[model samples]
Target: MQQCKLPSRQKGFSLIELMVGMTIGLILVAGLALMFANSSQSGNELEKSIRQIENGRYAVELLQEEISLAGYYAEIPLHGIAYSSPAACETSALGFSLTTLPMPIMGIAASNVSEICLTDRLANSPAFVIHRLSAEGAPSNPASAALGTTYVQSSRCSADGVPFKAATAGSASAFDLKAIDCATTNPQIRRYVSRVYYLASCSECGSVSDGIPTLKMAELRGTTMVVAPLVEGIENMVLEYGFDTNADGQPDVFQTNLSTTAGADKWDNVVAVRLHLLARTIDRSADYSDSSKTYQLGAASTVSGDASGFKRRVYTSTVRIVNEAGRRETVSYKPASSP
Candidate 1:
C-alpha cells in the first residue's frame, strides 16, 4: 500500500523548475551571441590594421629606393658629374681636370683649359641622363682618337622617356641642349640633381585623375609628369632635410622648409634627407573612443568627421639618401695635371 502511494509523485515539472531551466538555456544562448559579436568585431579590426601596415611599408620602400638614388649617375666618367658644381674658386683640381673638353671626344681638351663644366642629364628631364668623359689621359693620334674618341651624346634610356621640363626658373625645354666643359674648379663643379617628392590623397581606393592621382610634388626638377601610386590610403607626405654642417659624419640641421631664406642658403647643404609620411584608413568600423583603451597613433586624440566612433591609425618612417652624389668626393673632380 505504501509503495503504491509513493508512486503518485509529480508526473510533470513544476512551474518554478520549468522557469529555472528556461532561464539557464536563455543565458547560454545570450553568452554565445555575445562571443560571436566580439569575434567578428576583432576580425574586422585586425584586417584594418594589416592593411594600414602594408600601405605604410610599401610607401617607405618606394621612398627609400628613390632617396637612396638621389644622386645616381651612370658609372661612366662623364656621367659622374655632381649635381651642384662648386664655386669657381673652391672647385677641386681633380674635378676641374675631369671636366676638360667635350665628353668622350679625344683631342677635345686643349692645354689652355683649366677645368670642365657639364650639365646633369637628369637635371631637367623626367628621368636621368649620363654626360661623361671617356677616360683620363692625353688625346691619342688620329686612328686612336677614333678608337678612343668618346663623343658628347645622349645615353640610352633607362626609364620611361616622357619629356619633362625642369621646374627651375628657366625657359629651357625638355630636350634643350646642355653643355659640359673641362674647366672650372669649385664645389659648384657638381651637377645639381634636383629631387622630386610628392603626396597624394584619394577618397576612393582606385580612382585616378588625368592618369595622375591627386598628388602634390615638392622640388620638382623635371616636367609635371604623372607619378605612380606608392600605396592606397596615403593621405599626406612631408620632407625634412638633415645637414652635416660640421662634416662630423653626422646630421646637424633639421629643416621643414627647403626653400631659400633671406640670408640662409636653401637646402643646398643638405647631405642627407629624412622623409615622413602620414597614412590613414579609408574605412574604420571599430568603436575606438573607449577612454579606457589605447591604439596606434596614441590615445585617440579628437575623433574626426564621421570617424568619431571608428578607429584611426598613422605610421611614420625615416630614410637617408644612400646614393647621394654630393657625398662622393672621390669622383667629384679630376686631377689638375690629368687634363
Candidate 2:
C-alpha cells in the first residue's frame, strides 16, 4: 500500500519576463549584425581601393618597362634606321621603309591610325607605337620558328649591303646577312616588335554595354596588328614626348603630339617620355559618390569624371628610351687608342 502526497508549489517564468529577455537578445543581435555589416562594407570598399591602386600602378610599370625598351634594335643604331607610317597589316610597309628617318616613338589617334587597334577607343585617344626588336632572339635557324612570324636581322658586316632587314617567312631570303664575318652566311634572327598602346572603350563582353574602359595593345601578329587587353579599368592614357632638338641626347623640348610626317624625325629624337594613365574602380559603391571629379593627365589634357559613380585615379611615369638616348650620350670620338 502506498500513500500519495502532493503539497509542492511550482512557479515558471511569466510571459512578460520571457518577452523582455527576448527583446534584449534581439536588440543585442541587431547591434552585432549592424556592426558586422558595416565592417564588411568597409572591407569591401578597401578592397576596391586596393584594386584600383594596383591596376593604376601596374599599368604605369608596364608602360615604363616596355617603353624603356623602345628603340632597342639589337646591333643596329636607332639613328640610322628610317621612319615609316604603320599600315598595321602590311609586311612591305614594315619598319622604317616608308619614311626618310627612324620614327621609334610616335602617337596618333587609334581611330585614325588602324582599324585593327580599337573600334571604340576612348575619346579618340592617341595610340602610341613602340618600335623595337625583342631583347631575346628566336632560334638561330629561322626555319625552326613559326612560319608567319616577323623577324629582324641587323648586319654587323658593313659589306652586307644594309643596316637591317625585317621580314616574315617563308621569305627566308630577306634574312640573308653577314654576322661581322663578311661572309654570306647564317643571320642572327630577332623577333620584330611594333606595339600600339591605347585605351579601349570596354574590357570584356559583360562590361561592354556599360563600357568599363581598358588599356590595350595592338602588336604585330604576322603582318596584322592584333589587339590584346592588358589591364581593365583604365579610363584614359596620355603621353608627352620629349624630343631632342640638338643631338646632345637630352630632351630640348616637350610636345604632346608631333606635327606631321615630314617632322617625324622628331620621334627618333624622343629622349624621354612622360606617360599618364587614368584608372577606375570596376564596381560602383552605393555609399560613395564620384561627383565633379577632374583628373590631370600631365600637361596635355584634363579629364572630367562628373557623377560617373565610379572611383578613379591617375598614375604617371617618365621612361627614357635607353637604346636611343643612351647611345648618343657618349663623349668618345675614337681618338686613335693611345699609340
Among these predicted structures, which one has the highest TM-score?
2
Q: Report the lDDT tens digits of candidate 1 across residue range 124-183.
A: 111111122222343222222222122222213324232111112222121232223323
lDDT of each: 0.38, 0.75
TM-score per candidate: 0.48, 0.86
For every candidate in turn, the CA RMSD to the true structure comes to 15.7, 4.3
Residues 218-301 of candidate 2 have per-residue lDDT tens digits of 787775667788889998888888887777788777778556544533566788988888898998888566566789998859
Q: What lDDT is obtained when candidate 1 is compared to the true structure?
A: 0.38
Q: Residue 243, candidate 2: how far off, in angstroms?
A: 1.3
